[model samples]
Target: MATHFEHLHAVSASQAYKATFASHEHTPSSSIKVQCPIEVSFSDDTQTQLAYFLRLLKQASQQSRWVTFIGHEALVDKNLLQSAGIDLNKVLVVCNKKGHSVQELMIQALQSGNSSAVIVTGDILDFTSGAIRDAAILSESFAFVINRQAKQQMTIH
Candidate 1:
């Protein structure tokens, strides 16, 4: 059977594993008890990244759970999402502000039991290692942190 992680379009197995394992050191006898949240970074590929994000969000919403979208104002385009077949009703976009803490909001959203998946877009660097680990352990829901930047190496020379 395919795991929940397998349903994601943008996140690879190695990326997921690294994001999860980067939090702590594990011995040979140690085992991972909880699923690790994924971090996807996009540079100069907003369209492609958004497409993948929407696809993953759609898949997650299949479980009939709300999907929380935390992103900058420019990151989320309602029209794009609509055209991509995303159900607008299932999404709640949280706009990041100057004083507000995105990480804290993410943790609260995950622990609230209302959201099945949390999709965060912006700078991936803002999400610290501790925050990701804490969010992963606190909830069974899937978490994804997306970074939007200009892709520096898209051309093949």
Candidate 2:
């Protein structure tokens, strides 16, 4: 199954894995999990998607959970998230490219064992199935934004 963001033209992390799988033409023998962008970016929107994300984070923070942010876009997201009343330190920003970033950041986050949620760019192929599985296993909750090419690759896989 696909995610809501896919329909909205927003990127999801699973899309990256799907792209990797399709590029290899590997038959998907395992299931994948991905979460869509809670808010989409738009130049004309009355409010910024980032603002919405912040609002969500503020609400989520009432529960007092640690949140992690992954991806280049996450840099901006983290900044906005902090503005919405989340502790700036509570949000972790990942700076690596997809193929290399996910595994490393995931490992660090999992090892830290303090993160309550994660927001990452869609780069599924960056991590082995095992690593992805591990993240799925380890994170209490996670959000992924799948990029456009990921699904095309997945179908090819």
Return the top candidate by TM-score: 1
Q: Locate the minimum summed-lDDT window of 10 residues in model 1.
A: 25-34
Candidate 2 lDDT, tens digit per residue, 1-45?
333222332332334334324543564313223322222232233
User: Model 1 TM-score?
Assistant: 0.59
Off by over 4 Å in 2: 1-39, 45-48, 77-79, 97-113, 122-138, 144-157
- Per-residue lDDT, model 1, residue 49, is 50
* Residue-wise C-alpha lDDT for candidate 1, range 1-157, written one tens digit per residue: 1133433333432444433344454211122223555655444444355445565555556556677887653234678667767677887877766566777777777877777678775555565455565655566566777654433333322
lDDT of each: 0.56, 0.45
User: In angstroms, what RMSD does candidate 2 have relative to the true structure?
Assistant: 12.3
Query: Candidate 2, TM-score vs. the true structure?
Result: 0.44
Which candidate tops lDDT?
A: 1
Report backbone clashes per prediction.
6, 12
